[model samples]
Structures are given as C-alpha cells and as structure tokens.
Target: MGRYKSFLRQRYRAILGYTGLICLISGLVIISPLLALLAYPEELPLAWGFLVPGAILGLVGLGLWQLLAPKKATSLTLQEGSVIVVLAWLVAILVGTVPFMTIQGLNFTQAMFESTSGWTTTGLSVVDVTKASRLILLYRSIIELFGGAGLAIITLSAIAGPVGSGLTSAEGRSEQLAPNVRRSAKLVLAIYTGYNIVGTIALKLAGMGWFDAVNHAFAALSTGGFSTHPESIGYWDNAVLEIVTIVLMFAGGLNFVTAYLLLKGNFKSVVRNGEIRFQALMVPLCSLVILFGVAIGLYPQLGKAIRVSIFETVTCFSTTGFATVGYTEWSSIGWLMLILMMLVGGGAGSTSGGIKQLRVYILYRSLRWEIRRMLMPTRSVTEPSIWQGERRHFLQDDQIRQIGIFVFLYLILFCIGSAIVAAHGYSLQESLFEYASTMGTVGVSVGVTSADAAPTLLWTQILGMFLGRLEFFTVFVGLVRLLRDTRPILT
Candidate 1:
C-alpha cells in the first residue's frame, strides 16, 4: 500500500504540474473577454464575471504548479498524457462557464452546455443571440478558437521541453507538421491565426462590420457555428459573404499538414491525399442529391436551391454547422442526408469533428481489400495503402481493427444518444438528426436544441460533445487511469 502510494505520488507529479500550467493558460483565456470592454464600455460591469474566476484559477494553478512541480525531468506515459489532456479541457470548460452564468444569468446546466459546445467547436447554443451581449458572443468565439486549436497544442507552443508525442496523440492531433512538437504547434497556430486574419478582412470587405466579421471569422475558421445573429449566415443574405465563409470552412476542415502542404505549393501531395479525394467526391455528390431531390422543391428559384444545397452540404460534410437555412422545414430525406454527412465529417487532424474522412475512407478501402483478398488464391498476398500527404502509408490490420472499433463505438453512442432524445417525445428522425449533430460536433438544429431544453437532454448532448471532441478513447482511457490511480484510496 505504501509502495503504491509512492508510485502514485511520483507518477502523478508531472501530470499535475502540466495540468496546472494548462489551468494558468486557461485563466488567461477566460479573462480575454475583458478586452471587448475597450470597444463597448457599457459592458464594463460584466468584467467581474471574468476577473473573479480568472484570478481564482490563476492562484490555484500557481499553487498546484509550486506544490507538484516534478523534482526531476521525467517522461510522460500515454496514460499520463491522456489525463492531462482531459483535465485541461475540463478545467477550461468549467472556467469558461463562469461568464455565461454571471452575465447571461444562465443556470449551471445551460452555461456548461454552452462552454462545452464552444470548447468542442460544436456550435450548438442555448443562448438567445438576439438578446445576448456582444461581450458574451465574443467570449464564445474566443473559446472556440482556442478549443479548435486545442489546449495541448497551445501549451506545447508556449513551453520549450519534451512534452511527449503522447500529449499530441491524446489530443487527437497525431500528425505534426514539423518533427519538433513545439515547432509543429507553433506552425499550426501561425497558420490558424493567419487564416483568421484573412477571413476577418475578407468578411469586412464583403460588407460585414468589423465586429461581425471578427466573430464570424473566429467561428468559421474554428468550424464553430456560433453566430451573432439568430439567422446565422442567412442574416446577411449576401452570396459574397457566404462564399467567403465557405472558403474559410473548407480551410478549417483541411488537415493542418495538408494545409501546410498547400501553402507551400505542394499541389501534387494534396491531390494524392485520400481524405481530400473523399471530400472532393462527397461535396458535389451530396450537393447534387440535395439540390435535385429536396432543395429544388423547397425553393422555387434554381439559383437559390443550388446555393442552399451546396452550402448546407459543405456545412455538414465539413462539420462546421453554419447553416444558411433552418432544418425545421426540411424533408426527412434532407435530414438523413445531412446526418450521414455529419457522421462522415471532415479531414483527420483538423478542427472539424465526426468519424473523420480519413477513417471512413480507410474503412472503404479496407472493405475493397477484404473482398479482393477473398477472391485471390490462398498463397496470394497484397498490400493496401493510401496517400495521406507526401507519403503512402500501408494499411495494417491493427490500424484497420482500431478504426473499426472506433466507428462501432461511435455509432453505438450515436444510437444511444438518439434514443435518449427520442424518449423525450421527438420523432426518431429528429432525435437522430439532433444527436448526430451533437455527436459529430456539427451544430445544425431542428428546433430540438433551445434555451428551454430539458436538463437531461442538455446533459446528454454535453457528454456527446465532450466525447466527440476528445475522440472517445482519450477520455475513456484518461478516466480509467484516474480511477485506477485512486483505487487504493477509494477502497
């Protein structure tokens, strides 16, 4: 027992220290909203909401950092990395909830839901945008921006040390653009920041005010669907704005590695990428289907129908969830199609979420390979591979098996969440669509998610968003490790 206690103390010291550092960073993030006061001095009274929590968190983090700083340099295990990732996110979300509760007067449940949605880059919202202050709206966007890049990546970029590959992998960012994790993290941030600046400027030139442009740029690039207006992109009714947004969304959905390649004029690698190929096929195919089968009848004008189809399809396929139109009036076919798109999601190692395109494409390739294997002679063997970036990676059985398990678990959770929502009297289709949106981190709504939603429903979607954003395995493994480490004390 004594030995086990010593093991826990030694092993967890580094983890706690890292988590403390993340909390300190989160403290800075929480207080960032106070900057909005410079533009709108009327919102100055709401500053305390951010200040109180930020100070408390900063102090707590300082204490933990001092108390738990590792005595010597130690390597972080996968389990330790996962725990730090989960703890960092949870701390951010919890701290993020403060402003919503204090300024918006949202109850704990609603605030947590908003915080989770923001951090997960899941744009589902309970706040009434028409009534919410700009400060609150910017706060949501800021969190989404940071959340999309990930806290772990931010930490890696800030500190110089051997943080470990496990930290990046646990955060669902296994692909690094540079050999050094810190350099890769900085590159990601640089690219991400550059895009946001460009998006904001483009939107501003496209006729949006600076405030709206900045917020939408942040939300769009982060693949977070939060809008300043209730109508979202439809509020502008400007094709140019939508075009700019589409470009931003597409950029957000590309894997950072692929984006880097494109930026470097490596068109050949981008063309050969499996996930890009999948997206290229999916966007047009789904758009055509929606346009012909569903959108045309809904809109009398051909141009309007085509626009809606392409926009919504990209929104779902990219898991960006910035809808130009509401789904309440859409037919069942449209709902199902969007749900499928959400499930298929965007590129791996991107801000967007869902069962990433890489996995689905690999799964499709694996299916073909399995059939070919069965048809071949007993002595025959063939290797299957896919191009990710500049390299062709051979598909391994273990990799396929892990992806299969992940998809199976993802679908099971989707079904379970849908059923839970359906039990509240929504039809199976509505329940399925809503939960699919939740679990995919896609924020499209069919009127099920609102300010008045039941706490149980909100909580269920909260869990879904958390699981979706963290990609399940990390959260599960982290929790398991947490429990195992504390089992002796529990008993």
Candidate 2:
C-alpha cells in the first residue's frame, strides 16, 4: 500500500508539472498569434482571455509542483509509463483547446476536437480560418508546432529523465543516440524546430508571403497540412512553393531518429536504414505510376498532368494534405492511389501519421518469407525473406501479428467512422473520404465535414480525429491498462 501510494504521488506530481509547463508555453504561443492578429481586420482581443487562463494554470502548476515532488521511483512499470503518456496527452489537448475556445466561442466538444486535431498534427480545421482573427490563426499554427514537437515528449523531457533503465526497455527505443530520453527528446525537438525555421525561410524565398510561410512551415514540419488559404498550397499556384513543401514534407515523414543521425553526419547509417530504403523505393515508384495514370488517362496537357501527379504523390507520402489539384475529381484509379497513401501513411517516428511505411514493409516481408518457406520446405531449415538488414528484427511472428492487428484495427475504425458518417445520409464517397481524412489525420475532404454536417457525422469526425491522432493503439493499450489497474487483483 505504501509503495502504491508513492507511485501514485510521483506520477500525479509529474503530471502537474508537465501540465503547468505546457500551459506556460501555450500562453506564449497564444501571445504570438495575437500579435499576428493585430495585423488583421477583426482586431479581436483574444490575448486577454488567454492571459487569465494561463495565469491560473501557471499558479496551479506551481502549487502542484511543491506538493507531490519526487526524488526517485522504487521501480517503473510499463503500466505506469503508459499511464503517464496517456494522461499527458489528455491534459495537453485540454489545455491546448483554451486558446481556440476563447477565440471561437466554440462549445467544449468542438473546441476539444479542433485542439486535438491541431496538436495531433492531423490538420483538420473546424472553424472558417480565413476570416478568423490572427490570434486564432497563430494559435492554430502553434498547436501544430507544439504537437509536431510531441506535447507529451516535450513535457516529459522537462519533468523526467530517461524514466529509468526500464522505461527505455519498455518503450522499444534504443539508447543508441543518447544516454537518456531527455537528450533524445531535446535532439528531436531541436531538429523539429530547425526544420520549421528552414522550411519557413524556403517557402518565403519561393514567393510565399511571410504569413503564409510561417503557417505552412508549422503545418509542413508537423506534417499537419493546415493552410492559411482555403485552397491550401494550391492557393499560391507557384511550382517553386510546391517543391519547397515536398522537400519539407518528405523530410518530415521520415523517422526523426534517422534525421538526427543524418544531422550528425551518419549518412551511411541512413543509407543502410530499413525504413529509409523502403520509403525511397516506394515514393518514386508511386510517383511514376501516378504520373503514368495521369498522363495517359486523366489530363489533356502533359506538363500540367505531371505537375498534378507529382504534387498528389508528395502530398500522399508526406501525409501532408496540401493539394494543388483535386484528385478526388480525377479517375477512380487516381483517388484509389490517394486512399492507399493515406492508409500506408508516412514513416514511423515521423510527424506524419498512417500505418507507417515500416509496418507495411514488415508485413509484406514476413508474408514473402512465409510463402517462400512453404514452397521450399524440404530445401532449407529457414524461410526466404523480402527484406534484409535492420528490419530483420521485424520478421518475428509477434511483430508481424502486431502490425497486422494495428492495420486491421485501423481499417475497422475507418469503416466504423465511414458508417457513422453514412448514417447521417452522406453519399458513400463522401462517407469514405471523411473516414479516410479522419484516420489518416489528413484534412482533405469531399466537403461532407462542416458545421452543417449532421451532428452525428460531426461526432464521428470528432472521434475519428481522436482515434487517428493517437493512431488507435495508444488509446487501446491505455484503456486496457486503466481497466486492469482499477479491477480487483485475484490471488
């Protein structure tokens, strides 16, 4: 009982500290956006509201700080670590919503959905952002910025260290780059921030206005894809801007760890990386196929078609839904490819979301291995494989099963979401696209999602954003762990 009390106390204190820090940071984010809003017409005083909330939150955090402070844990369990992760994000979403709610007069539910979408880097927007105040616009970008930085991750780095030797072991990350998670978190954050800065500059130089540059940078680096203009990057009509976004989004979709390694001049390591190789092979091949489909079938002009093809491919792979053209209007084959891209997603540990290329690579590789084993049972003791090198670790039955389970659950959720939207009398295509957008956390749509959308469908979009952002499993495991913790233990 005493030990349990200690663990509870320690975790409670950590949550408070992290929450406070996020609130403090969120306050600063609110201010920046407010300053930006001053340049706009509304002249809404959104910053004042954030002031009170920020102050109250900081004080509460300060109070929480002194009460449940920690020295060390007797031990850390997977349950405890995961509990921390889940609670951390929940608090982040709640706190992050304040700016949105205060500015938009949104109900609690709508506010939460908007905030979660931004913080998750899902890029879905509920309110009409074009006429909205600068503060709100800036607030949206800040949400993407911090979210891409990983709210829990940033907070955790400030409040705790490696969590202990066991924390790293449980999380399935190697300490190959850093001695502790604090270092790793900082490294990733630095790279994330740097990427945004560089992307912003690149976009500005590519003829985007400073305002568009910053917001797009926030979206791109986060792989969130929220745009200041309604038409997104397409609003610019500049090929140079597309090139800039493609580079940033592609880089953003890659594993941050590998990006870190590359930063340290570990070029050879990235070259040999399993995920990198698969992503490298997939992008160009997908682009070529998409280009072929567009040129021969979809468009009358070749140059125009190729531009559309490359843009869609980049948008799909980067999981950045900044569209230059509506592929949804193209042939059935083209839309099908976009659908596949949303499902496949970007790389693991990237700002982007999806099943992640690594899992897909692993699943198919394992499939090939099993097939080869069956065909040559008498010829060898082992199975033939589709992948070699670092990803060999993914060949295990458990890994394959895990990947299959996630992919299946993701699809199931997508279907459930579609059905929910369909229940609202939306067309099948609209329903499916809504589901895809929600699951991929990609914001593109066939125009079904809106304030006018049936409330039931709205609710589905809300939950879809939640499921998509957490990508299902985190919520699943967290809920199961909570259930187990609350249940009576049998002797």
lDDT of each: 0.90, 0.70
lDDT per residue for candidate 2 within 132-200, as digits (tens), equals 766677678777887776654565456553555323322323332465666776777788878988999
Instruction: Give the lowest summed-lDDT range of ten residues in model 1.
Output: 69-78
Q: What tens digits encode model 1's per-residue C-alpha lDDT throughout 1-491?
A: 88888778777877888788789888888889888898999988889998999888988877777788675545677788899999989988988899999999999999999999999999999999989988899999999999898898887787656556778889899898988888899999999999999999999999899999999999998898889988899998888888899999999999999999999999999999999899889899999989988999899999889989999998888888898888878888888899999998888999999999999999999999999999999999897899987999999999999999999999999999999999999999999999999999989899899989999999999999999999889999999999888776445
Q: Model 2 reaches what TM-score against the true structure? A: 0.88
Instruction: Give the TM-scores of the predictions, in the order they appear.
Output: 0.97, 0.88
Best candidate according to TM-score = 1
Q: What residue runs in model 2 are displaced by over 4 Å at the alpha carbon?
A: 1-32, 35-44, 72-76, 165-176, 295-299, 383-394, 483-491
The candidate scoring highest on lDDT is 1
